[model samples]
Target: MTPLGTAVTAGTERAWIEFRRGFTNATDLGFYVVMSVVVFAILWFNRDTVVQVPGYELPSATYALPSFVGGLIAFLSVLGVAYALAMEREDGTLLRAKSLPHGMTGYVVGQVLRTTLETIAGLTLALVPAMLFIDGILVDGVGGLVWLPAILVLGLLATLPIGVVIGAVVRSVRQVNTWGSLPLFALIWASGIFVPTIALPQWARVVGQLFPVYWLGLGTRAVLLPDEAAALEIGGSWRPGWTVAVLVAWAVAGVLVAVPILKRMAARESGSAIAERRERALQRTY
Candidate 1:
């Protein structure tokens, strides 16, 4: 097999291994499950209040639930990438991977695949409860179902590169655990997950518009809400087409930034540098 083919095979294997690892990690599973339940329960309980908007019809409880769930999944996937990279760096696994042929490419592919799987799994888990509680989750019918997943995938793709950058920069697992949650919290809040963007200051709305979270929520709202609902102003009127374009731009930008940063990280991880760093860390702790 060609070198690229070998790398692809290795990446696939690594993805499977990581998926199993995630399953075995009871703490992570419990965290995700509990969060999903809480978010959905809150939405279910507040369905009447949410639907009480003056003119537009509110989204079904099922629809709102999935959007929040999907957003959480995306956030957690990014966190997973950061945690994986940080732990590998601390454990010398990253250093070992760098010694293999096409290692950097394989590692990047593995991270992407693993994150994608986790995101999909999380979304699925979130959807089940929504479907059970609310009728007609898709406001746009079959079209919404088809387009929603595509848009969400794009949104996740847009965020993955940023996750890669974070993984590359963080020095250790402890930092990853501590710092990772902050960004996730900020993005969810700013993206209008819990509150509409219109309620925020003008500048905050503008800043929120620049991130993938906003576009994700926008696309999701488009799928779940009626056309008249889309006309509802949030951060200066929601535009589904514009949201898709912006998300694509973000994904492109993420790819542009991630490639070089990942290369730099791979170069730095080579030889004995990571090992030496880990050794120093151990010594310092002892």
Candidate 2:
């Protein structure tokens, strides 16, 4: 097989291997469940809150569902990939991959596949409970359900490579907490996930509009909520065209920046570096 073909095949196999390992492990499952549980609980508790928007009359929690889901997409794509990359490098996965021809390509392809599947799984865990208990979440019924996958895939594309860049750059998983998780959480807050952007300060509205997270939430809300809900959004509209453009732009930019950085990070992986990282991890356990 050609180098590209070989890399593709290797990556596919690698993704499957990672998925199986992750699903079977208790810790991995917990990591997947905890965030979803928190979000569901928050939405569930707020299910009875009065929603008094003009012509926008559904359960308030249902309206908020899109933001939480979008934020989860951002969280899993960016922070999840960063942590995975950081942990794998420390565990010598990269070093082992380095031994193969075009290994970096295969490794990256594997990560992309692995993380996308994981994101879908994580999203399902969160949304399933919301759908079951939170009435009116699927306000548009069958039509809205059709839009869910497209919105999810778009949101994932918009944010996944950003995670790749972060994971590739951070020195360690500990650093990911400071650099990756903190900043993502900050964006989640500022991007109008938990609160409406219109309700935020002018500075915050602009800042929220500048990122894919906001657009993702907006796109999600556009799908799940009724047309009337747009009246509650900034500028009193969903602006589907703008949401798609902005998300596509972010996805393009993230991929452009992430590719070379991922290659550089992979190039730096070596047996000695992996051994040193392992030693540090071992020390941390003591």
Which candidate number would show the highest lDDT if scored against the true structure? 2
> lDDT by residue for model 1 over 151-181, one digit each (tens)?
8788888888878878888777677656776
**Off by more than 4 A, model 2:** 139-146, 276-286
lDDT of 1 at 116: 85
Q: What's the TM-score of every candidate structure?
A: 0.88, 0.92
What's the count of clashing pairs in each model shown? 0, 0
Instruction: List the pairs of residues colliding in candidate 2.
Output: none
Q: lDDT tens digits, residues 174-244, model 2?
A: 99998888888888888888877777888888888888999999989888776777777889998988988
User: Candidate 1: lDDT over CA atoms?
Assistant: 0.74
lDDT of each: 0.74, 0.84
